[model samples]
Target: MQIRDLPYADPGVPDVRSGTRFLLWLGRQQLGGQVKCLLWGLLHHLGIAGLPLGVGLAVQAVVDRDGGRLALAGVLLLALGAAIAAGDVMLHRTAVTNWITAAARVQQLLSRKTAELGSVLTRRVAAGEVVAVSTGDVERIGWFVEALSRFAAAAVTLVVICVGLVVYQPALGVVVAAGIPVLALAVLPLLPHAARRADVQREKAGKATELASDTVAGLRVLRGIGGEELFLGRYRAASQEVRRAAVHSARMWALIAAIQVVLPGLLLIAVVAYGTKLALDGRIEVGELVTVYSAVALTHHALRNFEEIAQAFSFSRPSAKRAARVLSLTRTTTTVPKPREVEAGGDLYDPLTGLRAPAGLFTAVVCGDPDVAGRLADRLGGHPTEPDADHTSVLLGGVPLDELPLEDARTVVLVQDKEPVLLSGTLRELLDVPTSGKVRAEHALAAAQCDDVLDALAQASVATGGDPMLTRITERGRSLSGGQRQRLALARSLFADPEVLVLDEPTSAVDAHTEAAVATWIAELRRTRTTVVLTSSPLVLDRAHCVVLVHEGQAVAVGSHRGLLATEPRYRAVVTRETDEELATADGRAVELDALEGESA
Candidate 1:
């Protein structure tokens, strides 16, 4: 079956049984191609199998010393040579087609799975593991697929030669028959070890690859913390371990190769010895002996294919497993199918959890563990997950959150992360995220207090197309300062202007003055729509209409920030620290800190 026909529903939720079934199903999709390849492979190999017979016939004619027969034999040899040449070409071409198609199908499945899992894919599997699957894994899978037809051809050729040998001379045929099983069975014992080593090698390689990817991704952070050398040392250790695994794997394969060569040679020796004895005893003719020996010699090539198929299968199985593991992740958070359109202005409610973000009000979420807040944000946006959880989702108006279609849910509920991604593009593009130019970019920019960011963009000449003024944003907007990136991200979210906005630490990177400005402006601008901010910043929290204090991952107190300060000691302490910081900064008096430094200098 062609890879294109393979079923790939729910790409991220990989079912290995289903994956195998899909591959089998794909074979059915391209029955015609498979049939053609099989036929061509058989014909090609059979033609090659005929060469030895033709040579034997010529030898027989020469032994009988008939001139007319010799001429016929020469003609037969010429024809056999031509057939073998043609068969070789067809065989190679069909095998390559099989390989390419199989690899293409696997690639399609991998691509589909990547899309289905989205960001969750990186959380579950390493980026390097994905890379390994795409490159080494697909190739190994293709090898097994291409090996199928070649294997069939080899089997057919083996049968034809064995039959021909038996029919031509029973005495020589007995020896050929006995040696054939030995040649085939001798490699079996070694296969398990080889397969084991190959599996281990692939695993080690994947780990090393994952380590490298993580190291590179965190290189900036490592450098900032003076841990680059330490990480590099760890990576070097990982590389060495991978090297050791590779050498061990190679050693096993080398042994297998040595065995394949030695056993075949021994079989040929036994065949020749038995044939010569039978020929001297007049039980087999010299010409028949030659044909039997030649068949046995040629069969070695076919037997080697068995070894290759085994090796390829060993490599491919683990890759398939890895790919399958990635595809198996189902969203644990559940949402309703077909979410109803809200009245454009209403409260967002989570009926299951009895949590509500009041409509047209600035609601603040205070979770002790920020991760829980992040997860809630993910669920609030209606990402996929299980339905059985205790969590009821935030809904709009009276409708359940789960009822919304994925696209509509995202459209109505925009979740701006603390560290929003700034894709590579002009500053204009960064400001206009998910931009269809629907929202007035200037209004959103103003609300998010992004005037300075805009000024910097204009000053830096950031534009799209060939304009040198348009500065290309480095990956993740690393070229910009942390505060600039944060404000730009905030601007993008504001531009979306969904019915409900979920902001997670949106102003964490900005200075206190900027944070207070943004918080006040957001509260003013989003007065007519629902806004939920997940943060611990007092500047932002003080402006919220309602503040929910979450402890141990559950909302235990719901009140205004001031009310919470009066009632909750934990909340009081957190806020008091911030108040102290503000007071300290405001005091302006220096305690001879610079004077002491000057004296020391």
Candidate 2:
């Protein structure tokens, strides 16, 4: 189907309005190629069927002692042989082009859908399903679309040959016509059962792929928790299930293949048996009888093409349905929209969680549950909504978060996490990422205390873009340690210097001394700007102007760290692993944090 029309297409299968209609639309797009392939296939089949007639004619001509007629028949046979060769070449070329074009059309539709949905794609569909649709499914769909054209051509050629035989020898023509239908119809029953089994096998394959992807993505974490073997066992079991399904599907296909061969042979036997009887009865001449028998043999070849078409359709239908499902996601109505009129200056508000970041202030969000905090971070980042999801309105200057154009919202809100990504590159390249001229690379590196990180990179001679200082990274930056990656990500975000910066445990992976230094630097750099830090670490919390403790997805308390410690037991319990540590060191250990506040000011 056309890419423009894909968005309006339906995905709910088992209905005529969805997958079937999409396939029909795709077929119509290449109707011209289909027509050409059909015509070529017809020419090829006719050339084959004519060979036997030519031989019979030559025999009769030689029997009558007519050398001129024999020579003419020989010339005609040579012409037919050339025509067959030419048609065979054209048939294959046109058919392959038609198939490839159909596959390309489907691929375009899928790619367009991916662009429309953006980050929501992963949340809506499995990553492996997308992979499968892009590759295996597209090829199968093209095959079926091309088969439809050849199927028509083959059937028509069969009919034309049979009609010609009947006119020449009605008895032979009748026998062939009867036997061809039986040969073609024999596979129909097995088709339904085979298709069902194939669908099951495809599902199992998708699961196996999904499991493998998940296992690889989580391999690091699995190793950390000693769960590698457990996951490996689960994946092995899933692979076995896939094998079982494949075996079942193969059995059904093999049975259909056996019938495809056996049924045609039975028809051949009938033709030879009946033709022998007629020849014996003297109702047909020896030459005509031989021609009739030859026509029967050629018809068998034509019938075999029908079996190929059947198998192609069986595979293609399900593939088309899956592609339709992926394309259909573009039509979903869930989308975030920006507001019409807005205040230039106000606090950012989140209605879902009743959280607000006041303008030009540092606010720390300490969530007792880290999972909720991560989800909240995603919701704030202008990413797609999860299915059956919950979200509060994140407002900027009293403007609803959803109402901000995605680009503008992204310009205003930036989320930096402790485990920031270190794409393959030099330390300078990582800091200068997003490459916008707004924030200088040196400035971001200084703010994130990345001097030592750069030194480490130099020592290792890492390069990303062939620049010794900008070399590429392997997948997922496996070369860097947890703390190094986090600092690099923070540097990149700082380079953006958005209006509101949200850092989630940005110093959690670093050592206590590094965490204290980063927390102090972050405070100094973000002074007089709106900075919301989501953290449970005492190091970062001690630097915030205000700390808001979130418990069970709600703001339970809001105050400075010392104020919360004196007033809110829940806040004290969350931020401090040892509540008595403060008390144990309290005697003659009063330390003033006023200098840190003054440094920010």
Candidate 3:
């Protein structure tokens, strides 16, 4: 795979069984590229190996006083140099292509996983770990993959040189061949130590990266609570720990590098010394002695490739494992046989909680614990946020929610989260999400009570003298206020106009007046659709056709807002936070107003 073919037409499923297996899978995917890289690398190393033979021939030609042999040696030398240069350039290009393509494939896989899991991904995996895996870990995996071809070529070259040396001069060949293995395997003992240190350093670095990401994500909240300095101090401590771990890891690797250099130098010295002794004894010619000496030096260079390959594996193993872990995550729910589509405008019923949002009605679910409400909201959709089988089946139009295709289920029931993300884009682009297009943008904005948001966006755009639809939003809409962001998210959901809309605390960030307006508009606009709102606010509950009071993770009472106020004590405590007498007086006045309206009619 080349860089241009990137984002592979088919990234293909990864082998998530193990880190080593994953690396092998990547190599298999780019077998053609690997082969090309190997060929070029082999030619390059062979050229280097031939240099000694060329020099020896040249020396013999000079001693024999043969001009023709000398000219032939010069031509062979130039050809070898050309081969080396061409091989080096192509090898580099192919290696880089392999590296980039491998990384891109991994990134594509991660991105697909993220989309499939949605918000639940962060719950299952640490945000920092995901970032680290997608960024640094991917590169490390690619690096190892690219290095494999070079390592293979180096191994082949070492063997060929060993055999060539033995054929040319067996006495010197024995010493050089014996020493090459030692040079290659000498770093084996120190590798475990280096790998352990690298693991420690990587762990510390991940923690530091996670801490920084968390700090930046909540910087606004920290500043608001006057805790920025606390987080900053914590980050500084994490950074220092990472630095220390890095230094320790570098120290181990430095020792290995020293060994790599020192061991090879010793072998070179031994070969040269032995060859000199043979030459003095007239056992080997001067030209043959020079070739043996130069081959030893070239072999030392090849041994460095072994050191690099060892380091690459040490760093890439853990990274590949992390990536494999993420890829291995599968949905806990069993695949639904004969997956079906959900009927439009069907009732949403959760058997576990005995909470039902009847078709074409606004139902409010009030729970003492926000977490329970959030889970219930997720359950209303086909996908449960928690990976527990204990969750009871939810049905839409008598079809099990989980049995519907994911996309079909999502189309039938749109769940607007408590903290919905507003991706960075223009106002129009934000609202242009996939939807049935039954609701107009202007009407949805009105239903969501986003007048202030539109005005703010307009003002900002005007200041910059740009079109409002073209105004750029900051990442996560950080520049917008909490309430504005919330309203914008609500507007986006309203624009979707799905069959059933499950909103979890949609107006929690807004003031009482705006919340009341939003509730009224939502109820009015969605009167003919199934809308299940998970909120305890009196304004929204009063607007609901039916209010289900959830306690201990179960719906204990279901009734009209006024009837529940006059009845269920837990309901009153959760929603109103008022005494029975105050509620009673309110209920009495409500009854009196109903009587008055009846008499007038």
Total colliding residue pairs, candidate 1? 28
Write the residue-wise lDDT of candidate 2 on 225-292 in tens digits.
Answer: 99999988998998899899889988988988788788767777887788889889988777787787
Across residues 226-328, which tens digit of lDDT does each residue of candidate 1 receive?
9988988988888898899889988888888888889879888988887788788888777777777777777877787777877776777777677666655
**Worst ten-residue run, lDDT, model 1?**
6-15
State which candidate has the highest lDDT: 3
Q: What are the lDDT figures for the candidates, one per model?
A: 0.73, 0.75, 0.87
Please say which candidate is ahead in lDDT: 2 or 3: 3
lDDT of 2 at 314: 75
